[model samples]
Target chain A: MDCTIVKIGGSIIDSPEQLQRFLQDFASISGAKILVHGGGVMASRLQKALGQQPVMVDGRRVTDEQALKAVVMVYAGWCGKNIVAGLQSLGCSAIGVSGADADLIRAVRRAPVPVDYGYVGDITPESINTDFLTLLLRAGITPVFCAVTHDGCGQLLNTNADTVASCLAAALAQTGHISLTYCFEKDGVLYDKDDDSSVIPEISSGMYRSLRSEGRIAAGMIPKLDNAFAALRNGVSEITVTHARSLLSGKGTKIIL
Target chain B: MDCTIVKIGGSIIDSPEQLQRFLQDFASISGAKILVHGGGVMASRLQKALGQQPVMVDGRRVTDEQALKAVVMVYAGWCGKNIVAGLQSLGCSAIGVSGADADLIRAVRRAPVPVDYGYVGDITPESINTDFLTLLLRAGITPVFCAVTHDGCGQLLNTNADTVASCLAAALAQTGHISLTYCFEKDGVLYDKDDDSSVIPEISSGMYRSLRSEGRIAAGMIPKLDNAFAALRNGVSEITVTHARSLLSGKGTKIIL
Candidate 1:
């Protein structure tokens, strides 16, 4: 993959020292790149501080207007800006962007179904403005994206980070060969759920299904893995699941079809 | 100015109805444009909401670590993102940015003299990335900037809105015929301080000095005009001081050499 789109999970963002170390490694990767990041843990904490208990329905946190604002503040404001600044300090030029920026990504508000997700956005790869993003990338600016999108009619919508990464890798595949990575606290897709060092070196889609049948993979990992596989199908060259610290060395699980 | 750089002061931002009107008019103006905005009032209020009383000395707010975070959250997160979204609603494509984004503007932290204004940044026209800005503008993306800058070494600093506007207008003058506008609650620099309709239609630099000597201008207007005059002298073709409602019709005080 000539250009990498890395999705750094919320766990990496919880510790400042760890986050700085991760950025130091992320900046060392050579090529035009993009960063899409998660905000759940931080957003939840900030929401509590602002006197609102986060509302969770069916194991998913519902995004109300207040919650949306809180998350936008944390992801786009704290994480996105500081990550770009950290990259700058490391001699890698980066720019922070929300989906509303330059109309880079336009999403449709999710329709209320079995439950109302409330201000959640759903995006397709076709909705992304690859032409404008290519201009930014060719100019040598690494676009650091937050988990916020716009409805084109001017409303901010909360989006899942993994989905953002998947859509971007698919949309921007033509810019260069695309490598999509999901970095979190774990080493990779683990062979033993309880052991941090039990990294499974490789997992094909059929293997992923068998592991799911055996109930080995965590429930939360399913959607993320689904996103990774979708990205691969849509033309991302490869998918890597690793802890942020090991990104530069390429030590992690590689997903295959 | 072929490209207009407009600074919306905190006074105008204080009122939601007024801000919306201003943005509508700002979006209606034809040609490339950039928006610089002030945030001390909103940031202070948010800081107070978060249980931190703002520290103020001699008309200036001290930007301690907490205050800096407060301002960044308010300006870059809430204000900047929403402004771009608001402009999008008006059919203008705008992207929000901090100085750290794309290395658009670099600044140096202010040194302690009589008072340590901790975390405040001072910038010059030379520090702005005119080339990058021109690219964004040429691509028809309006840049909405917050009062946040970076020290290039990973520190984000709080810069004055007027300074951000002045520097941008001066630096971007080469892009086209430049007209810089400062929009606030008041109509313009008023001849009679109590009367909003008593705006001084035109104030030459010599006239500004004479008005200063005569003690007719308000103290706050002095610095804003100083910035306006500086932009005019730095190759910006014109400077307008007006209320947001008068933005397109060009009804306001015009500063001259």
Candidate 2:
């Protein structure tokens, strides 16, 4: 009867071992509905092997034709299925869907600006399908997601996984489910990136913004915080910023609106 | 002393026969630099044979984890080499690159909103290497690009071939190149989708947007317009939206700023 939206970041969930450990934890929440978000780190790895360099502006990927293809392989093939298999190993039924299916996320193509960034899109919230998540949850299936979305014809866009989790959690917040974000690193939400010991017990939407403004949060943490705030604004309750293991103890920075 | 960027859409360039025709034409272009964009309509057919319904949204295919793997096999192994071999047969030096090979297009990950879209990215133009393109052109080699790009840390996004062509053209536009977007269907841009004979002479940015807003342009035309506008904005000298055969006659719609 309960549901939890969880986002697994690329940094923490890097290897099979980490993923396996997370799956073991996930299996315990059998009766509870779980939604997942992952990808990015692995995508970076595979993008390198293929020899295409990635470009980013304002934290989001440019996702040109080439990078977009790489994303499809890394997110869908490598990240999404691996997590699904990991969850399946632990006896959880998992189905992976991208933004293109069911018009789940309708995004407007963002034109190249500031620097001719190509084929990027912005989320159109009105077009999101909250009901689909409910249907999946009602059916008791673990909906695992990768960061690739479609522009409604056949072109795939490379979106951030953390942002996807946050957006989904926000859309499905009305269902009264608990949302949690998981990265491989430290305890949960921390006051600083370098000092793992400075784990912040909680983060307010305003305080999180200030932290970002002060240049305290960088790398992958900014999007997580921004998405968490967005989710909170959209009515998700009890968001936890933490690692997978800490979920059991309910330990991590509690995200508050 | 002349450059042409050719974008092969999923529908028309999908078949071997269609691809061969395009390659033969490309081989015939004398003293002109060419860049080719390709996708795996064939692979999607193969994937469908395996029981996975291809997920699409707003003209973009959702290249999730599984689809990504299939595409890698299809694009790099099948489509990329297939085109390369065709070019070779025509006595042209051709080299294939996905987003992974040259750090060609850097991107960041995109997040899912309605669904767990897997592994899509946004393009970061700052990271695109025009030098690689220039070097290839200088060497008198035709660069055949698979519609896959990289996220700076090694992830790929399944991007639109039209968008890729636009990106490449925009990047190399200053060298006085003409961007030619070719698909199979008709010989030129149409005034109506139903009438293949209704060839529109030219479309300005405003006119294109108006038509799209009025629902006059949808399906395959959307990416073409999106990329055309992108190419114009990125400083491409001119863009010709037409079919493969119309290239010689300059019969397609000339997209002007």
Candidate 3:
């Protein structure tokens, strides 16, 4: 069996119209699929509204106890459920979940010796419950995941959505062909951060190093590309970075090993 | 096969220690089971924090757009996932969900003819997707549901948790024996408002009618008992109102026809 795992970033999720449009395109895709989403923008807004300061270090959120609650409320509750409802309206059977649900993705809390990202977790391919995921996929249920995980011991942890998608793809790649797609506000990984038309058609490992050395890749895209290459190495068949609306058209950057 | 459906009210959910104790007892239940939860207290606090006023009419929430968002975040996002994680820590495979997830429960938005409850939905036994639920139960996955439903058209609505439990019990009763239990702060239906030890052991329909007629029933307990009777009439094998701590003790008010 073949599976498609799409990761939508917070920018797309922040806009209702854009999200609905993306979901419409997503619903049109056939076969086993999963949607992993980021809700950082919403979470930040919620934190601000609730009198908590949103803090970030090296583009990763510093998820303190309050931030964890905000992310869980925004990501799993508001954003994830809305996406599931939207997909359902488009005739797709979508189930929204966090990694804690059914122990789908158990993560270990990151060590505090390095930057002290409170309540943040790191996951791997082995952390994913592929058997359970396979059952749902085979049963025609599309899982919509929010970027929230657990430590297997009752503690919820905030995770990066891109990492979640990559790990899920890598884990599921053991049984079937898996296609990993990163959809965000931009058309693709841009050579120039200011220019939308500067999307690199494709990038190999060597080219990625050269681009990084030349400072052509945006700061925000380095981690995403790293996750992409990791998935490729872990048996994922294909990886693409594209705009949310360009899902069906395949107009984006493809990552190759 | 027999199944237990437990509905935990907001009062119990508002206390961490009480909820943890209840989850421990719930994990000890040796059978297929489902947990439905209400987070009205949390939702109300969240609404106030977000500068939104929560209004209730006839004990039903007036779920305007903002209120709906607050409730969805608190119930489905915060409360539901935490419970799932707690149960998972206790070795119960729990999956948390809203009604929109997998289209598990589709509800109809209430009409404004009688009273306009904005974004409020009404559901029945036919609204539940029992096949998907049964599949999860057979797979040893305990579903933890939040009292949020969808209109099957990208609209999330606020629903009473008690009603959700009764409907689920009635719907699942078509295939197997179902027991519906309502867990709250008090021990059971009380003979007097101020007496915690004055639990009415059993109540028949005649006694219920007399209690209601004599103004002996509390305003809050009426709807819960009404939902219990509805479930009993709809083929549920048993119904009980018990304290959260008394889950395994069987020391509660049993409703009989």
Candidate 4:
């Protein structure tokens, strides 16, 4: 049951060289199933280029009708295929997926009552069917997931990559392989982004709340940590957060109970 | 009252030079609202390269979970943006859209009754909102649409470009605009493919029906004719089927009731 879910963040995807190297490394890992989660950095860049300043409320991009379409074009088309091509060039079979496919990732539209963030959504766990993932893995195909989900009402919405990665990890956790998240900028679970030396090698569930109270882990890292802890508590065997290059070098922070 | 829905077929889009010429001509037209429809020739080619044979039932391609993602990557990512870039070079503000955004084109997933077709679907016209198009046109923005629709139930399905163009034409008919479908191969609507001189200058509903009965329209042309008539019946004042270069030259079969 050697199956691992790896999330490739959008920040790293911006560099073609980095992506190519990652694909080369990814192909060498044999006997393991993989799932990918991508972000909308490229799409977001497009919005800025088009003079539509992105409005973000509580970590979610405010996806008005126009922004939603732009993101869809960039995420599903640009980012997804480039990765698939990378994997293909390495002779690995890779399949790109969005939540709309087979209702792969059903989401509840977060109607930002306080802010009016038009089309952003949240993942609804009950809607995910891991059996599809099982089938893909059994077929020895790598499923590359994009950070987009359907509200189950015909409309597709942009979702957070961390949450997507978490859901996929939890979905495949029963197979004994751990969840690994790769980001470009950060070292392994730093106690403070400003201080690299404060990096924590490992943290238990008990320390997370205090760390947050002390405001140690914040920004995008907070939700990622929260999702990781939730997955671990929900029966996921293990989870790790780290830099892409460090993953193979055993230099990441492992989350524990 | 001067809006026009212009459809650029997949064949023209298959060649970069042809596509560039179309974009240049598209920029020359003024005082009319333009809507673009693109095909999935490149995406379909990539799909075959990936070893996932397209599953088609009836004449429509079934977008399975994997293929749906592939199309998004190919259509919106590669083809849509590239087209928009070309149009932009000619000073047109082009926007790319898929069925998932704002429920642009809702669909109902047909049961996989056609044995080889895995996940094909049909459109739900009532779900398309022309408000976005109206807004873009009012702002002098050209809206480029891809032939994909959401099934209102969290599924993205492959639809025919002709159908999408017809629907858009019908949706925009209130403004008394014409719909023009551009193919790259021939100068005009040919009565017979073998003899270019057998070009049909005009086609009425009855003539089109007789052509169909005589088996003159086969395979791909069947949908084009069906959609052309469907647009006229629904509300479009006029519809033209011809070469993209002839769009401005008025060298095509004009279909009217």
Instruction: Say which candidate scores most in lDDT.
Output: 3
Model 2, range A62-164, lDDT digits (tens) per residue?
Answer: 7777666566655654455446545544566565455654345645666666666565556734546666556556655677766666565435566667767
DockQ of 3: 0.92
- lDDT per residue (tens digit) for residues B200-248 in model 2: 8889988987888777774777777777777788778877777876656
lDDT of 3 by residue, B189-219 (tens): 9988678888999999899999899898889
Where is model 3 more than 4 Å wrong at Cα? none
Docking class of 3: high
DockQ score of each predicted structure, in the order shown: 0.77, 0.02, 0.92, 0.09
Candidate ordering by TM-score (highest first): 3, 1, 4, 2
Pitting candidate 1 against candidate 3, the one with the higher DockQ is: 3
Descending-DockQ candidate ranking: 3, 1, 4, 2
lDDT of 2: 0.65
Ranking by lDDT: 3, 1, 4, 2
What are the interface RMSDs of all the models? 0.9, 15.5, 0.5, 14.3
Better of 2 and 4 by lDDT: 4
What candidate 4 gets wrong by more than 4 Å, as runs, is: B1-257
Candidate 1's TM-score: 0.96
Taking the tens digit of each residue's C-alpha lDDT, what string does model 1 give over A165-255? 9999989776568999999988899877888888999988999999999988877788888888888888889899998888887889998
Best model number under DockQ: 3
Q: Model 3: per-residue lDDT, tens digit, A1-257?
A: 69999999998999999999999999999999999999999999999999999999999999998999999999999999999999999999999989999999999999997699999999999999988999999999999999999998999999999999999999999998999999999999888888999999999999999999999989999999999999999999999999999999999999999
RMSD of each: 1.7, 19.8, 0.8, 15.6
**Looking at model 3 chain A, which ten-residue stretch has the lowest summed lDDT?**
A112-121
Residue-pair clashes per candidate: 4, 89, 0, 1
lDDT of 1 at B15: 79
Docking category for candidate 2?
A: incorrect
lDDT of 3 at A34: 97
